[model samples]
Target: MRKARLGVFKFTSCDGCQLSLLNLEEELLAVVDLFDVAYFREATDKPLRGTFDLALVEGSVSTERQKEEILNIRDRARYLIAMGACATSGGLQALRNWASLSAYKARVYPSPENVHALSTSTPVSDHVYVDYELWGCPVTRNALSEVLVSFILEKKPALRGYSVCMECKRHGIPCLLVSQGAPCLGPVTRAGCEALCPALGKPCYGCFGPKDDANVESLLSRFRLMGLRSEECRALLDKMNTYAYRKVQGENRS
Candidate 1:
């Protein structure tokens, strides 16, 4: 059988997600046996050509050029997978979506006029159709494995949809919010990190982004009741997955 053609592309990101794939290390041999490994400069200096069976794209679209590239990739690939928080939810840079572009440029750049950038960082889905999204700051290798195996088997990958709270319970970790009064996004954030932070006795940073069933209103109210100011509540939701949470409007905007 002809092996599936695989490609990995990067944009403006820390490249941690790609690193996870490379970190597969001992297990990578298994994946390699199945795929053609068509294009991936991060793992190898391989040249890219022709259509791909699957393209795992990282980073959000922040430039007109990348927007065009993503569309073209979507057109060519049999399937397009947006990897990590960056590609799925515009990443941390999406915080600028609501801010003053001129002021932001003036402050961040010495020659603001020379800056070739957009006012917002948006997810890949904003520009093209996505077959799947592997969420994380750097996507977990386990999730990547599941997706890869599913694709190879011609079956849908079983991506979880519940909140991280379920993982906390499964791991028998006490609730930080209920027991310690800590502001934990685990109640509203998606599962995948396995409650890693809360397991280590810290609050969740929402690296996997908010769950679709996330109750942003109740979470913010809980924050306010716990002595967080309006601005503080707003700031809590303004991190990496800012664009993914749609239920946070009208808070601290008076």
Candidate 2:
């Protein structure tokens, strides 16, 4: 049987998600054996460019060139997977969506006109049809493995959409929100990090983005009850996964 041609592409991100793939170490060899790995700039100098069986795309579309590239990629790949917070929910850079891009550029660069960028950083799904999304600041190795195996089996990947609170329950970790009055976003944030922050006795920062049925307003109310200021609540929800959270707010209002 012919090996499935795989492609890994990057756009505007910290490259942490791709590092997670490299960190697979021993398992990475098996993945290479199973797929053709036609294009991965991080792994090779000479990359084969063409149609791909599967494309793992990281980072947000933050420029006109990236917008065109993503569209072209969609046209070629049989299956496209948007990986990490950047690809799925615009990552940390999505915070720029709310601010003045021109002002920021003018202040940061000597020749602001030379620095060309989109007004807003957006997820890959905003511009094209994505077969799957792997959410995280850097997606976990377990989730990555599960997605790869599911594709090989020609089955739907079991990417969980539940809140991080559920993961806390499974691990028998006490709720920090209730016990310590910590402003935790676990009730709204998507699971898959296995409640990593909460387990470590810290509040969840919603790095995986909002879950399918996240109630942002409700969570805000809980935060207020915990004596958190309106600004503090906004700051918590409006970082890392800000684009996704803002979208949730818009949907609820509509």
Candidate 3:
């Protein structure tokens, strides 16, 4: 059987998600055997040519050029998978969405006029249809493996929709929020990291983004009960997955 043609593309991102794929190391050999790897600038010098069976896109649409490229990529690929927080929910750079882009540019750049940046950083889904989303600051190898296997099997990936707290329970890790009064987002954050930070006795920073059934208000109430001020609660939610948190809140409100 002809291997599925794979294309990996990058935009405004830290390339951490792509690194996770490469970090697969021993597992990468199996991925190579399954996919043709038609185009991947990070892994190979091969220039993009024909249509792809699958396109794994990382990063957000933070510029006009990227917006156009994503649209074209949508047309070229039979299936498009947005990888990481950047591609799925606009990454840390999306923090600029709530601020003055011009002011930020003037402060950061010597030649502000030379910088061609959009006022907002947004996910790929905002620009075009995304068949699937793999959420993380840098998606975990297990999630990548699930996606690859699902693609080969021509089935939907079995990503967990539960919160990270479940993973904590499964791993038999103590709840930092409950036991030590630490401000943890595991209650609202998605599973997949396997309670990594909590297992190490650290608070979850919500790198996996919000779970589908997240109760932001309830979590905020719990935080307040734990002696966190209103500002502290807001700050916690307004981190790496800010856009996603806001979106979920908006959906709940509407």
Candidate 4:
């Protein structure tokens, strides 16, 4: 049988998600035996440039070039998966969506006019039909392996739904939210990291983005009840998936 063609693409991201594939290590060779990794320059210098059975894209559409690039990728890919917070919910850079781009460029860079970036950092879904999203700062190897095996079996990948709190409970970790009045996003942030931050005694920074049906407003209310200021609540929600979370009604965007 012919090998299934696979491609890995990157955009405006830190390349952490791409690293997840390489981290597969011994299992990575197993995947090589199953598929023809067509384009992943991060792994090899001789990446094939053509249509693929599956294409995993990392990073948000943050420029006109990337906007056009993703469309071409969508046209060529049989299945396209947005493989991290950057691609699915705009990543940490999405924070700029709330502030003035000019002001940010002026404050951060030495030459503001030389800075070339889109006004908004948006998810892949905003510009194209994303077949799936891995929803993480850097997608976990466990999920990547599961998705790969699912592709071979011709079954749907079991992603989406489930909260970080569930994973915390599963790991027998105590709830930081209840035990210490921590302003945690575990209840609203998507599960997959196995509640790593909470287990380490820090509140979830929403690195996986918002879970399905996540009640940002309710969480904010809970934060306020815990004596958190408005900015504090916004800051917590304003991490990797700021724009996506801000869309959750009942909270003020400004």
Candidate 5:
């Protein structure tokens, strides 16, 4: 029997999600045996050609080149999964959309005109259809494995729709917001990665993106009640998953 062909593509990102796959180490070998890696520039030098059974796309679409590349990849791949916060929700770079990109470019570069980029860094779904999405700033290895196995078996991936608060409760970890006065996004963020950050005594920065039914307004109110400034709340939501947060906010108002 022929194995499924898998392609891993990247655009503009820290490559953390891709690194998560490499961190799999031994499990990666097992995954390799199950799928033929048609394209993975980070892992191999071999050129990628033709269509693939599954394409794991990382990073946000920030340029015309990325837009075209994503469309082409989507057309060729049987399953297109947006991997990581960048591909699923525009990543931290999407914060630029909240401000003037031209001004930002002028301040950072001597020749702003030379910088060829889109006004907004957008998620892959904005450009083309995405079969599925694996969230997180740099997705967890377990989630990656689950998604791969589920896709191969033609079964829906087992991802949670609840908030990270559930995981915190499951692990018997103290509520950082209540105890330490740390602003935690856990209540509104998706449940995954086993509540890693909160368990480490750090507030969640919402690396897993928003849950299916995130209450952004209530969360914002909670943050404000905890003495977090409005600007800080705005900045917090404007991070990696700004688009997703904005979408929720828009929905709340409408």
Candidate 6:
């Protein structure tokens, strides 16, 4: 059988998700054995020019050039998987979508016009079709490995759909919100990180994004009961997964 050719692409991001792939350590070698890494600028300087069997795309589309590049990659790759919070849901930079990019540029730079950028940071799916999405600030190595293995086996990757609360229960950790009145997004946030923050007695910061059918309204009401101001609750929901939360709010209002 011919070796599967893989390509890794990036846009506007911290490259943390690409780093996650490199951080696979032992599994990195295993992945290399399963597929030929035809293009990865972070790992090599070789010129990449061809279609690929699988392409792992990281980062959000934040510029016209990036949008063009993403479309080109999508056209060439047979399977395109969006990796990390940026590629999956526009990442932390999506915060600008809720605020004024002009004001931000004016405040931070001497000449705002010199900085060529788009008004909004959007996910990969906003530009082209994505076969799958791996959600995280920087996606977990275990989950990434599973995705790679599944692809090689021609099977669908089994990503968890439960909330962080389920992982907390499995780890036998006490609920930080109940015990210490801590603000937590665990009840609504996805269950991929194995309840890392809650296991250490802190609240889940929603790094893994919102779970399916998340009850944001109830969570907000609960937060308010625990003495969180409306503004504070809104701010918490406006973190990495702000777009998802906004969509939920829009749906509820409709």
Highest TM-score among the candidates is held by which one? 2
lDDT, each prediction: 0.88, 0.92, 0.91, 0.88, 0.91, 0.88
In candidate 5, what are the lDDT values of residues 1-254, reduced to their tens digit? 99999999998789999999889988989888999988998898878699999999999999989989999999899999999999999999998877899999999999999999999999999999998889998898988999999988899999887899999999999999889888899988998879999999999889888998898999899889988899999878778888899989899888
**Candidate 2 residues 119-230, lDDT tens each?**
9999999999999999999999988999999999999999999999999999999999899889999999999999999989999999999998789988898789879899
Question: Of 2 and 5, which scores higher on TM-score?
Answer: 2
Kindly list the per-residue Cα lDDT of model 6 for residues 106-173, writing each as its tens digit. Answer: 99999899988888989899899999889988899988898888888899999987899999999999
Poorly placed runs, candidate 3 (over 4 Å): none
Model 5, which residues run further than 4 Å from truth? none
TM-score of 6: 0.97
Q: What is the RMSD of candidate 6?
A: 1.1
| lDDT tens per residue, model 4, 1-254 | 99999999999999999999899999989999999988897987764577989999999999889999999999999999999889988988888987899999999999899988998999999999988789888999988988888888999988757799999989999999899999999998899998999888898988888888887787889899999999988888888888778776434343
Q: Count the backbone clashes (under 3 Å) in each candidate.
A: 0, 0, 0, 0, 1, 0
Tens-digit lDDT string for candidate 1 (147-188) = 999999899998877899999999999999999999888988
Better of 2 and 4 by TM-score: 2
* lDDT for each residue of candidate 3 in 146-242, tens digit (9 for 90 to 100): 9999988888999988999999999899889989989899988999999999999999988889998788878888889988999898788777688
Q: Between which residue pairs do clashes occur in model 3? A: none
Instruction: State residue 201's C-alpha deviation in candidate 3, in Å.
Output: 0.6
In the predicted model 4, the residue pairs found to clash are none
